[model samples]
Target chain A: MAEKIKILYVDDEPGNLIGFKASFRVDYHVLTAVNIPQAINYLDNNPDIKIIFCDQRMPGKTGVDFFEEIRISHPLPVRILLTAYTDVESIIEAINRGNIFRYVKKPWAEADILSSIDEANKFYTANSMLMVKNEELQKAYAELTKFAYSVSHDIRGPLSGMLGAINLAGEIDDIEEIKEMLFLMGKSLTKLDTYILSMHDYYSLQRGELKITNIDFNKIIDDLKAMYMVISKSNKIVFTTTVDQGEVFRSDEVPLRLILNNLLSNAFKYQDKKSTNKSVEVSIEVHKNQAIIYVKDTGIGILGNHIGEIFDLFYRANFQEAGSGFGLYNVKSAILKLGGNIEVNSVLHKGTTFKIIIPSI
Target chain B: MDKEFSFIIIDDSELDCFVIQKVIERAFKNLDIISFQNANNALEAIKEQGVKTKPTIILLDIQMPLMNGFQFIEEFEKFSPQIQDCYTVIILSILSATRAPADIHTEFNKRIVGSIIEKPFTIEKLLSLLKNMGLADEKIVLSGKKLLP
Candidate 1:
């Protein structure tokens, strides 16, 4: 069942307050105050009060004055005025200055009060939703500006480098030096290709819906091994995998592949070049409808301060190697879409490990 | 043409550094060139060399990881006048001209910065810049190969 809507009623007469509470307490969480100070206290304490009713001709202040003051302080609540005397000037003032939604007579009908409450609640709901969407639109606008700046920098940075290299190639006469320039140009193209692929993955992950199916850990691990075989062999890094899955495991294959590919690529990319005993280990265990996987590598591990910010968009820990800084952010987003959690453990110059656990949907 | 001056290239991209070094080398005979991949490391080297370092023209890239070109100028401003006066900086970046000039006017130290050069720097641009600075008028060598004598 839906929760009851809360409403506030303020009056100078205690009898009127009690009667108002008794009438509406069954359908609403009704709060009543006898004086202006007490009414302000109720508003301060109860932020979720959606509808407000104030009676005119109070002791110290009029209901119109109270509504006018709260129009700035508590603008989200719908305000209504209740008065015994039918003064046309004050009623017009209440509508124009006090911003009251409706004015009811002293001898109000039960049906009229109920209908006013219903309309006021509907206005409150629509206003709250508008505020939420306005905030979201502002946030997306800021993100889009930052995204545009980063995209230009990432793409142009490499192309400019290539142009510089090509100009140098024309003036040089030594074949070996020219060959070296060609090698560097090849590296730049590779960086460009990697960045484009990451952009594609980012777009699809944002727009595509998840497709869940029964996942076979062994088959996925074998495929990964085959994909990375040549690079692992050339780099002299031993890659090993072990999977202990005795029960069924289900997940979205695309995101799962994205997560593993990113993690495994980083494991191979950040290895200490001088380290002779380079290795990567992958271990997975599935039980109790959860899959726990670990990807460990012997690499130049991340510094302690950078671990917290590694998942942020366009954050790079080091400039020693070329990267678009989208790899780990995509990994984290994919893991979140699969309802999974990941933890990182690392020691500088030693190694780093990522442990992830995902539950079957 | 015996007056000696060194060139310092500060850019994070190794390939850009290599290209700039080659371009500078081809234009001048036996000119000293130093390149650092990190801005902080370059600052450390400058401080270590102190006032004894040779008169230098620094080619600085704007977008770096830890310290940017403007931040490097901010640090450079704290040096003694004797050391500071020995170097002049020129920005080398891929930033658009409309934005780069405005940033240089507002954020950079006017006295220390000589000018701004867009990326993919060529030898002709470098020689033209040196001529404008009065450093190419018989004081600096022009390698005599496809260069204005």
Candidate 2:
């Protein structure tokens, strides 16, 4: 059943307040106030009140005056001023100033007031939705500006480095020296390409719709291990995984892979060179429709102060290497889109561990 | 005799470090240039070297993965004045239009940053800047190529 729409009827006359409550009590959560102070009290207490009706002739405050005053604090509720036929000029001025949604006649008919309440409720809902969407649009716009700046700076920085190497390569004739320059140029190109690809993933993750399906944990784990095989060997870090899933787990696969790949690569990237024993351990368990995953790494761990902001966009916890700075941020966005939560634990020079719990869709 | 100085290249970009290293190597002989991709690692090195380190010149990048140029300077400020005053920190970045070096120097003081140089820098600009700061006394020669007319 739909929740009852709350309505507050304010009138100086006690008889009118009683009549208003008696008429609409069945359909709405009807609240009655004898004066402006009582009406203001009701509004303050019941924030969810959708429609407000006030009598034009009150002790010290007119209905229009009360409506205008409440516009700032109680703006969400639709305001309706009740006035006599002789008060046409005031009603016109109040409506012109956009203080009230509509004005009801002094001797309001029960049927007429009921229809007005229904219309006012719909208007209130639409207004609230617009406000929410506007806020979202503003936030997205801000992020877009940041994205533009990041793309240009990150992409051009590498390109310029490659350009300089190429210029120098043309002037040098020695094969060995040219070979070294070519190697550096190749690395610059690779970095630039990777940044572009990550930018693509960031956008798609934000705008793409979730395609929920049965997720094969074994296959995903195999792919992850294969992907990081070279890096693990190069860095001399042992990689291990333990998966325990009895029944088939279901979730979106693309984002799942995105999250795992980023975390694993970071494990390899930030390892301490001096540490003799470097390793990454992955554990996944699925039971009772929830998949719990843990990726722990014996790497140069994040600082205590940076732990909270590590997942924010373009926030790098360690300056170990030049990266897209979107890896953890994208992981966080993908996890959130799947209605999951992730937590990080770390100590300086020790290691970092990430725990994630995602309920199956 | 010219005062000998070492350098710390605190940039996340390996390519930027490579280019800068080449420039330095080509222009001068027998100079110590230490490069770190991460600021924290550089901080560790600075702490170890302490006052024994030479009058070091730091080429710092503004936009880095962890601990940007400004954040690194904030950490650098925690060192003793003896250690702090021995180094010249210069902001080298592609983000010149967005961030002003003078503004940062005013905010952090000249003790933190000597100046800013926009990226895609040439050896000529770098050597001249060093000379102006009185860090380079020997005439810089760029691989049989004259950087100054």
Candidate 3:
């Protein structure tokens, strides 16, 4: 409507083609093509042409066939078909192939033809706007992820130095109180370390290209237990497993470890502060083409409303509790990457459980 | 952990270079200290040092006028093996947080320069660092007073 709307008109009848060229040719650059090949050639020659009009009743190839083939080879113009009521089947087929934006009846009025072109132009503009908005959104998301990654790296480096100094504080003998202080420092470091590690995994999940591997679920559990042996001993946490004994699954090992580590750490971190009885139970079960790992903790359980967004990035269920807010986010992302899913179940002041399901294959 | 070595710090900023100099001094008491207000004169004095029998560690300040720490490292790197061996350049600055010692380690390796130590160094921090720098001493004697027996 602004200026110089271009269109390609295809028909077998020379008279009808002339008629189309005569009507509304003043405001438009109208190209006439007698066959499918000529129409394709015109489209290639004039790229600025914004709309396409094809006539269904042709000698050799019908408009529907031409439109279907146009999809693969050509970046189509907004397509409209001029066909008789008898060619309804062909018109319907064209629509199904996503070839035609609309259909016009034969012996079309000049004003009707002009309006159709106007409608297609508006539709084209709206589609372009949607595409631009999508691109901008993607760019914004990428920048936010980059900022999170940098913050994680900066925070971790200093945290490392802090932990190193704290660990070295044990050598001085006169400062007997420093021993108790080191215990507190170690606990805080563990809390800080957990938060930082969760952040690290979250950043990696958002920005990383994962390295996947085949793993035996039972073996992974055993290794995890070995890794946390010291912590389990100090806390007097009795860990129990209900795995199906010998089961193997294939997925990315790195994220899988992250998911399990976070779950296991949380099971330890949020234990009932008052209750002397402390323990954790983990189980692995398989359903056709998918494997489920259940991490059940006898700890400070989650609230009902907060259960909805447990996996939201940096979303903390318990503000007072020591958490980095990235654990569940990483768990969700890793599971998604493996073409799997995760869910949570909890009862306030009772217990919390995470069901992590990865594709068994 | 790294090999223990003698070191010196040259800076007009007493509070600025205080902790770092003490670190080198206590960790390796064998280290000699050289304090300077300007790097240009330091460069001139270093160039005249002709030759030395043993390595004399040099911790160069980066913010000094006429020539900064990097420029000094560039010039010090060009000196004869006797002088270069004695010269180890540490770009002591407070602003460059992300600039790590690894950059100097990679470029200089065992030659061109030493390492970077972000400024406002503390005794507690430096002592821990020196321990890792291959000082066999089990305890880092606190700076200001003699270690309690």
Candidate 4:
């Protein structure tokens, strides 16, 4: 059952407060205060109170004045003013200045009061939803600004380097020097290509919906092996994989593939150049609707301080190798979309291992 | 022309460093050119070399990981007056002059920063800038080429 909505009623007369509570206590969690000061205390203590009812004939302060004072501080609660028919001017003031939602007659029937509570509760719910959406919109706007700045910096940084190289290529006459410039230009082009590809992945993950299907670990392992075969063979790094799947597993294939592809590529990219025994190991186990996978590498591991930030967008831990810095961020996003989690362990100059646990949809 | 100055190129991009070095080498012969891929290393080198290094021009890139160009300047400002006077810093960036961060225009940075040069730096721009600074003669010769008429 849903929790009862809280209601607060303020009146200078103690008997009237008890009567109001008795009438609505069954339907709402009723809170009563005999004066404006006591009512303010209740409001400060019970922030979740959704409706406030106050009588206009209170001594020293009227109901409309109390609502007006709290209009800025406790804006979330719906304020309803109770007044005698002779006090028509107070009703108008309540509507204009106090921002009251409705006005109840001083001698109210149970039916009219119940209907007002229902309507005011609906308004409160909608207002709360709007506030939440406003916060989300503001956060997204900030992310968009940062995204624009980073996109411009990453794309132009390389193009300008290539242009500079071309300018120098024209001026220099030495063949060896020109060859070196061409090599650097080639490297810049490669970096640009990698950046564009990862950008495409980032957008797809953002806008695409998950397409869940039965996942085949064997096929995924085969594709990964085939993809890295040439490079792994040439670099003399051993690539190994073991898969144990005793039952059917279900997940979104696209994101799962993205996660493994990024992790494997990093494992290969960050290998110690002089280490003759470079290796990457992958092991997968599926049982009882869960998949646990590990990808371990004998590479120059990340520094301990940088591990916390490696998953952030456009964050790079090491500058020795050319990276788009989108790889791990995209991997984390895809994993989140699949309702899974990832963990990493590494030691500098030794090795690094990534463990991922994904539940079947 | 008689006073030779060393060049310190601090940029994370190797290709940009290579291009800038070649452009400077083509325009002038046998001037000392030092390049660092990281800004922290560059700052350490400046501290270690002290005043023994030649009078230098530091071409700085704005956006880099760990330490950016502005942060580099903040550290550079802490050097002694003699060491600070030996170097002239210029912002070398892909951002246009108008889009550069407002911090670049602060009075503190203004004292140390010589000028802002957009990316794809050219020999023509470098030569004109040096002439305006009175560091180069009005007519300068390219290496192994005739003097500009």
Candidate 5:
């Protein structure tokens, strides 16, 4: 045995208790309680006691009554009944009410009692494991339900919009009017596509395991710039990146890319279109063990009250524009899985900045 | 339809609002129409208009961000009985796959909602609903056909 399995025996006869303890003390930690109050006290003090074998015919309270009493206060410990008589009626009643694990006939055989103890210990471990796994399954099922609801809501919202716009497009005869409607339809289609991609990101973040590898910061920055080149040029926004790194950092490459991609996209998405000077700056500073990145933008910043809940799923601070609201949530989830931290600072209508610190290991 | 009465749409989706607006335009002539994308703003407008606005029908969307269709009804119920009596609410929902719970349907129906219209809304459905409510009376051009009995 790896360790002694703790057990308690409650009986009225002193000799019986002594004989049971003498036989079983070698294989397990055997504790004896002469009465109901003593057993209750032992149970209160040593909650780790895995099994209890109680004598049925005790003074004042029967073993069934004692088991019923402790079942509520200390429910985890498995209970067994020991009686000299073969009373099927009382045994059936005890099993039905208290969910007694086993019924032992006394004068019990030494081998039978040892075997009962071993079986009870195995049952206790299995029951506890089942309870733990049941809780985990319930949690995972709830999250799946929430994810399904979100997908339906996000997808259907834009689809209805696009369908309405298309219906309107067919009715109009003027070329310019139809063109404007098409532009709006295009926006709706883009929103739907963005939502689909965000859903993809969410599933991958939840299901994919982290792959640790050497990350080249310069190469990642160059790729991001190339990706957002058209967006920056059209919006008249000055996009810049500065990297201060001496050696290659170590982290999950995919998650790092996801985090940066989301933050940079948000920075560009929420930029103040009417502002004369629009800029998004990304700065990365790497030390021997950590990398700190800053994504700063001159944009429509988040409200003070909403900043705390910005990372929440399906949370859109600005309702005028189209967003899946999963961007920041996915970014935060990735950061947590990477053993990293992110913080945001913003001034409404002026600017916003995100600071992230990721450990390189 | 009575010229004194008008149509009001309170929906967060701009596209849905635009579609409803176009449908109303084609259904009737010289009828006043008001629409809002924000529920709070719509509530404020209704409150400011008060008893001045004539008997109106509201098309309320259920899935707004902050203040949903149910919340709007709760707030609208707080208005004076005379002001509340001037409006009949109808729910507009895009989620046809799942219906609202029976309890919610019962609760909203008790207060204001007359019916629910699933998207994408058609001209016939809107006109039939209006006709049932004793609003649309005249023979009108819809989809280049005369709307008849």
Candidate 6:
């Protein structure tokens, strides 16, 4: 059954209250009170009453006066003052005094009274909804402020550190120190890149649209190996890759790129730089409708305990060491968003391997 | 006499330590550069190196997983005085000043630190860092390349 709207009619004369009830009782859950005190008592008992209809003239207290007394304690019951044609001035006074919804003329048509009640119900519901939405919006605004503060203080903080280091390096007049300055500048630049990527991840997760499309695993791995040649060359680590062609998944390739780029880059990062035989190898295998890509590197592997929580936000194996810690977090969020998963196999001092699996289409 | 020494930069971030090692190696051609990603292992090796006076500097990164730079220093204190004397503490970090209060710059300037350098530390600042630490009489090395104009 539809929720019935309760309405209360108040008049000094018992006949008027009885007549009002006879008119609205079937269509509404109607309550009649022959005096102001009785009306207040009815309102206390029937909390669901949404609209109140009261005669402007009463034996001792007027409708506006009664409403004024209860305004602070029992607010939100929509009020409509009832006045006779001759009491037009009192009706106008009550409207201003009680902030009434609207007034009905005494000896009103049955149809007019019912129509007024219907309109009052609509007004009450609409106002209630707007109030709820407003509260929600206010809550959202508070949360947004906290997010903004964290982004500004933490996200930009490291970038500013880079900027300071760069400026300090530039101040040196030594002819021989230029090379060291540029090298230092490069490190600072990468930290800046990490910060920029962090901002990108946030906006993308919030409002940016990721293009979902089929991506070739073989091609992505090949490209990744080629791109990482610089790190391999510098570290003197052998870059090797093996890929077994597999069916592509329909997912956003942008997130895939970020995930792969970060993982591969991290793999190279921990390699034995002074050892010429050090290497990073990437291979993919397809099985049971799942496409698995493995990035294995003969580098300083992750700690046994750290693997489980590497994907947590703001957690870095090395805090403020170099990476923003946003990389793996973004990858995890991206995978969850795409309905995919990732797993890690690592042993300290031996190496670390990340196995990323996706539904093959 | 131009002396050459190998420096072990122990920092959690391979990138920052790599930059430091590269810059130092370039400036001083004969400065052997070694890198370690963990503190406890590095401390163990540092202790085992035997202190009878060989020229060695350990560029320490402050924040790491198992042990921070200070914690490493605290443990290093347990070593023989002569061995501890061989290594100098140069604090490396992303500076981590964001979580700190507004007066961090004032606090960071306290002379307790031999030198406080930021990450992605460029060659020039590092050489100045070397100069500031009295290690400037050399060339900077980055990724096996000697950075000397």
Provide the overall lDDT of each model, using Cα atoms, as 2-decimal numbers: 0.86, 0.82, 0.67, 0.88, 0.84, 0.71
> Candidate 3 lDDT, tens digit per residue, B74-149?
7767778777766555555443437543453455444544445554444554455444543325643343124312
Each model's TM-score for chain A is 0.80, 0.88, 0.56, 0.78, 0.69, 0.54
- Native contacts conserved, per model: 0.54, 0.54, 0.00, 0.68, 0.34, 0.14
For model 4, name the residue pairs that clash: none
lDDT of 6 by residue, A136-184 (tens): 8896687576556445534444455455445445445675665665665
At residue A132, give the lDDT of candidate 3. Answer: 86
For residue A137, model 4's alpha carbon misses the true position, in angstroms, by 2.0
| The candidate that achieves the highest lDDT relative to the unseen native structure | 4
Q: Calculate DockQ per candidate and list them.
A: 0.57, 0.41, 0.01, 0.62, 0.41, 0.12
Q: Please give me the DockQ of candidate 1 compared with the native complex.
A: 0.57
Model 3 chain A: ten consecutive residues of lowest lDDT: A153-162
RMSD of each: 3.6, 4.1, 18.9, 4.1, 5.0, 11.7
Lowest-sum lDDT 10-residue window in model 2 chain A: A314-323
Q: Which parts of model 4 are misplaced by more than 4 Å? A: A1-77, A81-99, B1-3, B139-149
What TM-score would you report for chain A in candidate 5?
0.69
Q: Please give, as one word, the docking class of candidate 2.
A: acceptable
Sequence-dependent TM-score of model 6: 0.47
- Give stretches of model 6 more than 4 Å off: A1-172, A206-210, A233-236, A246-248, A318-321, B1-66, B69-149
Count of backbone collisions in candidate 5: 0
Q: Which tens-of-lDDT digit does each residue in A1-361 have in candidate 2?
A: 7999999998889999888888889988999999888889999999999999988888787887888888888889998878785556886877865478877787999878988998998899999999999999998998887777787677878877777676555656679877877777787787778788888889999999999999889888998889889988988899999998888787899999898988988888888999989999999999999999999999889889889888877776665454677889999999999899999999889999999999899
Each model's total of backbone clashes: 0, 1, 1, 0, 0, 23
Residue A24 lDDT in candidate 2: 85
Question: For model 5, what is the alpha-carbon lDDT of residue A106?
Answer: 89
Chain A agreement with the truth for model 2, given as TM-score: 0.88
Off-target runs (Cα >4 Å) in candidate 1 are A1-49, A54-75, A85-100, A238-250, A285-293, A357-359, B1-3, B138-145
TM-score of each: 0.85, 0.83, 0.43, 0.83, 0.76, 0.47
Residue B137 of model 6 has an lDDT of: 51
Report lDDT (Cα) of residue A246, candidate 1: 94
Highest TM-score against the true fold, candidate? 1
